[model samples]
Target: MPLASDPIRALHSLLRSTLRITVTDGRIFLGAFVGTDKPMNILLTETEEFRLGPGENPNGRFVGQVMIPWKMITKIEAQESVVQTRNQLDRDVRAGYIM
Candidate 1:
């Protein structure tokens, strides 16, 4: 069953769960929840660390670990596949179409 089949429920679930977000430009941000007064704008907090390596750098001289509110965010990734699925459903519902 698709999440869009129940838009309200999907959104409720999303709001209730903590999210592991990957921001635009491939930066990861984890937060407790999201708030969006406008569909295009979201607010999140409780972000801790950022990782910029494929693995522990062998050189140990690489630039990794950054703070929150990076300057290159273009989108927010809902870490779980179900979150993505629910987001898609929410969009579909908002569009008055179900998929």
Candidate 2:
């Protein structure tokens, strides 16, 4: 894991790919898999939420920029690799992604 905690990977990945993330609550989000943590909490942007939960409002809709808790992540599918452009790297550097 260790992919969460900031916006670098989220921003970079947002530029490159879309992700299908499923949560334990039976909610699924199709969006850019922007960030994740060691516990596998997820962050997504431009999301369409497929609500399978009990709540009606949360069922089958789109939500922008969502954070899924570590306890909630069930699965994630990425159709393509996340690209790391030079611009992204520069941003990462400025943001302290550098070691």
Task: Please give the TM-score that candidate 2 achieves against the real structure.
Answer: 0.53
Q: Rate the local accuracy (lDDT) of all candidates.
A: 0.54, 0.68
**lDDT of model 2, residue 6:** 60
What's model 2's overall lDDT?
0.68
lDDT of 1 at 74: 51
Q: List the residue pairs that clash in candidate 1.
A: none
Q: Which residue window of length 10 is worst by lDDT in model 1?
A: 59-68
Give per-residue CA lDDT, model 2, range 6-43, as digits (tens).
64644454543787878887778888766766766677
The model with the greatest lDDT is 2
Q: How do the residues 47-81 of candidate 1 rate in per-residue lDDT, one tens digit apiece?
A: 44355777843333322223335344555555577
Ten-residue segment with the worst summed lDDT in candidate 2?
80-89
